[model samples]
Target: MKLNVEQRKIVELEPQGHLAVKGVAGSGKTSVAIRRVSFLKEHYCFEPDDRILLVTYNKTLLNFIHYQFNQLSEEETYDSFLSEHKTDVTITTIDKLMYRSFKARMTRLGLQLKTMTNRRQLLKVMNHALYDMKDNYKDVTILSPKFQNFLLDEIHWLKACDIQDLNVYQEIDRIGRATGSKGMPQKLHKNSETREAIFALKEHYDRLMLKEQWVDFPTINLMALREVEEHPPEGYTHIIIDESQDLTKVQLMYITHVQTDKPHQSIMFVADNTQSIYHLSWLGKGRAYTTIGFDMSGRARTLSKNYRTTTEISKAAYGLIEHDEAILSNVDFVKPALIDRHGHAPIYRFFKDHSSHLVFLKQEIESLIGEYQYKDICIVAKESRFLEDIEQYLLSEKNSSPSTQSSKTRF
Candidate 1:
C-alpha cells in the first residue's frame, strides 16, 4: 500500500535527536515506524552489525510489528532486508529487555535469578508489609482492604516512574493513575498523613521483596534502569518505540541509555494517547501521562487520517473517549475521517441473566461458524470473569475444541 502524505513525511524526515509521532488509531503509525527503519537501512549507510532496537509493551504487539516489517520489506522490494539485518535488529517487549540487562549484571549485583511464581505470593507479601506498617508506626493509619490495594498500586506506579524516595512519592499527585482510567474516584491519599502511611508501607514492601529475593515486574524495570545507568549497552544506532504513550519514565531511561548519542542517530516514539492504557504508570495528570520527560523537547508530529473502521464506528469510539474529560485533555481528539467502506451498523443486546447472555452468544457463534474460522472470531469482555464464564460455557455446552496456541476470547 502507498504511504499517506503524513506517513511519507514521517518516513522521510531525519530527526536530529528524537521524533515523537502522535498518531490516532489506524493512522498508520506502525507503518510509518517500519518504513522509517527501512528508510534508514537504505539511506543512512548503517553498518551490517549496527544495532536497531524496536521496543513495545507485549509479545503479541512485537509479533505484529515483525510481521509488518516483513510485509513492508517485501513491498519496498528490499528483498532479504530483514534476513540481512537479523542480528542487528532487535524487536522485543520492555520486560525482556530489562530481563536481559538484569541477567548481565546479576552476578555483580548479587541479585537472585528468580521469577514471580504467583501473583498471590506478592499480594501476601504486600499484605504482610501493610500489617507491619500499621504495627510499627503509630502515625500510620490502618487501611481498609480496598484502600490497601490502592496503596500497593500507587507504590508500583511510583516505582515505574523511578520514584523510590518517600519524599518524592508523597509530593507527587495522582502517581500516574489518570482520572480517566478505571477504579473509584480519587478518594485515597487525600491527606499528608495517609500518604505518609502509604509510603511507610511501600518501604516495608520493598524491604520484604529484597529479603525474600522475589523478583517482580517493577523490580525488573528498576534493576534495568540501574544497569543501563551503570553499564550502557553498546552498538545501538537507532531506537524506535511503539505504543510510546504507555511507556514509563524509567523505561525511557533504559532506552536512552542503550542508544548511541551520535548526531545522525534517530529515536522515534509512535503512539496514540487516546489508546494509552498505561495511565496508572504515568504518575501525573493530562499530557504529562503520555509525554516522557526525556522526549519533552523532541520534534512532535501528529497523524490524524485513519485508514481503519467505518465512519460510524470511528465517531462512536471518539465520542465515547471525549465523554471522559480527563482523557480528552491529554489527546488531540481529532475526529478521523474513516475509510469509505459500507458495513453493518453495530448492535447492542442486553440480557437479564448470564444464562440468556450465554445462549445468545452461543447462537451468534453458531451462525458465524460456517463463514468464519474459530480463530478469526474474537469475543471481548470488560471483565476477566465474564470471559471465564464464556470459556466454561463454550467447553461444556458446545464441546468446543479449545485451541492451545491461541486465546479464542482475549480481553
Candidate 2:
C-alpha cells in the first residue's frame, strides 16, 4: 500500500503547498486523493476524525467512492486501517460541502437564516416572479413568446429530474399551461444547447433572488465566497479540489481567493482540461472555461498506467479517444501502456447502410453472448433514448432484465 512513483512524487512535490494533479480518464486521480489523505494523516500526525472534504459534481460518483473506501473499511481489505483511523476522514459532494460552508458563514454575510432546497421550488418562484411582473421578468425567464411551449416542456423535464414534490410539479404545470401565462423572453431560443443556459439562468436567478429577498444556489456561492474571504472556516488545514475540470468560472474565482487568503495551507487542484464538461459556462465575457494548466506537479503528479482494463480494451478505448483530434485537443496526458488482455481481438465495424448496420450490430451482440459467454454485457448508448429498442430486442431474446434508465429492461 506504499505510494507508487507518481503518487510519491505528488506527495513529495506538495505535502503542504499549492498542488494540482491533471490526467486523463482512469488515471487514478481518486486513488491519488485517497492515498493523499492517508499520507497526510501519518505525516501530519493528525487525528483520524478530523474532517477532509472530497468534492465531486456528481452524486453517483460520490456514492461509488464511498463504496470504494467502505470496502477498505470492511473486513476483507483494510479493515484494521479503518478501525484505527475511521474517525479521521470524511467525503462529501461539493454541493453539500458548499451548503455546509454557507450555513457556517451565513451570519457573517448579513443573513439571519440560511436555508437549502431543491431546484423545483426555485423554478416555481422564478415563474411567479415572471407572472407578477407581467412577463417582463427583466428578460430573465420569459426569453421569448415563441418558445413558451418549449419552456413549459423544459420545465416538465426539469421537474422529471426533480420529482421529489408532485405538488410543485402540478402547480408549475398548471400555471405554465394557463393561456394567460406571462413573462416570456423575446430573445431566447428553445433548443438542446439551450438546456445548460436555462439551468445557468436558474443559477443566476438564484443569485439575484437575494437582492429582492429571494435566494438560491448561485446566491449561496456568491455570498459564501465573500464570507469565507472575510472569515475563514476553522479546523480545516488544507483544500484539495477534485473534478476541477467541471467547475464554473465563478466557482474557480471563489476558490482562488480561498486559496490565497489561507497562508501555509495546502491547496491542491486536480482536473483534466479535456474533460472540461462545463466549458460553455466559461464563454464570451469570461476566459474561465479554457482553464490555464496549473502545473502544480511543481507537486503536480500523475499515475497514468491504468491497471483497470486489459491491453486490448485499453487499446480499443484509446483508439476511440486518442486519434480523434477534437477530443485530444483538450488533453495532455500519456496514453496508457496497453497491457496483455488474454489475446482477445476487438472487432469493429462501420456500415454504409442503416439496415445492414442494425443487422450487423445484433449479430455481433449475439456472437459475443452466445459464442463467448459474456453475461455482463452493458450496451451504453450516448443518446439514452437509443437504448429503448435495443433493450426490447434483448429482453425478447430470452431472460434480459427490464430496467433501463429510459424504460425497463431486465438482463
Candidate 3:
C-alpha cells in the first residue's frame, strides 16, 4: 500500500519482518499506525478479516488505540456497509487477547470456572464452619452475598502474597487465560484441624463452572504462549508491539515464540522507555539482545518528539529520575503542558526545636482549616515513625483541649 512519508516507512520499510517503533509522546505514532492499517487494507493486500491483533501493554493504551481507530474511520468516511461487512480486526489489551486463547485450551483440561470463583470457595469454607457448629446442614446457597464477597477478596489478597491457597481449582482454571509459566498447584492443607475441615468442604466448589473448562488470568498467558511456541500463528505477517518497556522477560519470550516460524513478515515494537519504569533484571552488565536472542527482519526506529509536555515541566521531571542516560536518552513528545505544575516552588520547612514546631503546626492548622475555611489540608510525612510521633502529639493536644474538634485532626 502507498503511504505518506512516515506511514510508508513504518509499514513498507526494508527487511520488514518486525517493526520496532520507539515513539515519544507527541510523535504522531498513532496517526502513522492508522494510515498504515488503512493503506494495508486499501492497497497492501491484507485480507479484510485476517487475525490482525493490536495488543497494548495496558488497558489505558488499548482504549486510546480504539478511540484512534474510531476517529480515523470517521475522518476517512468509508461506506457504512463496507465498514460493517469488513473482516473484524481484533484490538485489545494483551491480557484480554491471551485470555481468549487460553480459555479455549483450558476447556479440554477438565476444570470448571465460576463467575465469583474465589468467593464460592470461601462460602464452602464458611458452610463447613456452619456445618461444624450446626451438625445438620440444610443447604449451601443460603450464605450472605456480602460475607462471601469479603472472603473471596481476602483470598485474592492472600493468593497474591502466596500466604495460602486462596483460589479454588475453578479459580486456577480461569487463570489459564494469561501467557506465562504455568505455576504449580497449591497443596490443600491447613494449620489447624478446623481450617483443614473448611478446606475440604471448599475443594468441591471447583466443579461449578463446567466439568472441564475453567481458567484464570495467569494461566491464560501461560497456555497461549506455550501454544504459539509449539505452533506459531499461521501466515503471521507482522507483529506491532506497544508499551514494550513495561513487558516482562517472560512476556517478551512469548512474543519471540510467536515470531519464530514466521520470521520473514515484520516486527514492530513501539514503546516509550521513559514511561514504564520497571526494575532492570541485569544488575550492572548491560542486557544483550543476542543473549535473549532477537533476530530482526526490520529496522528498529527511534522516534523523538516532545508532543505533550512543556520545556519547563520536562526539564524539572527529568531531574527526578536516575538512569543510565545512554540507554534511556530519547526526546519526549509529551511532557507536562501546564505552567508550573506539581508544586514547582514547594515550601520547605525545617525546625530544630520540637516545642516551637508543635506550636506553629497547631496555629497553622487552626488558621488554615478553621479560620480560613479551608475544607481540607494535608501534611505529608514519608516515614511511619514520623507519622506516629505526629499522631501521638495530635492526640495529646486534642485531649488537653476538649473544646477543639478532635475528629478534625487526621494524620
lDDT of each: 0.71, 0.53, 0.48
Number of the predicted model whose TM-score against the real structure is largest: 1
Query: What's the lDDT of the predicted structure labeled candidate 1?
Result: 0.71
Query: In candidate 1, where is summed lDDT lowest over 10 consecutive residues?
Result: 402-411
lDDT of 1 by residue, 279-394 (tens): 45342234542345444444778887777777777777777766776666664344466667656677768999999999888778777766876777799998888999998887
lDDT of 2 by residue, 5-123 (tens): 77667755545656667666666777677566655655653443244445666698777766666555323344555566665444566667666667767655566654435556655
All candidates' TM-scores? 0.86, 0.61, 0.51
Better of 1 and 2 by TM-score: 1
Worst 10 residues of 2 by lDDT: 279-288
Superposed by TM-score, candidate 2 places the C-alpha of residue 193 at a distance from the truth, in angstroms, of 19
Kindly indicate the candidate among 2 and 3 with the higher TM-score.
2
lDDT of 3 by residue, 1-411 (tens): 123465457654543455556665655565555455554444433443343445567888777766666555334633442365255444557666665555555565554453333645546644544444343333322233333433333333222222235333323222111222223223323343433333433333333323444443333455666666665654334456666656644455566665433333445566655565443221012232343456433355655544456655455555555354534443322222333334344344789887777777766766665445424666667566766776677667876654345455344
Better of 1 and 3 by lDDT: 1
Q: Which ten residues in a row have the lowest lDDT in candidate 3?
A: 279-288
Candidates in descending lDDT order: 1, 2, 3
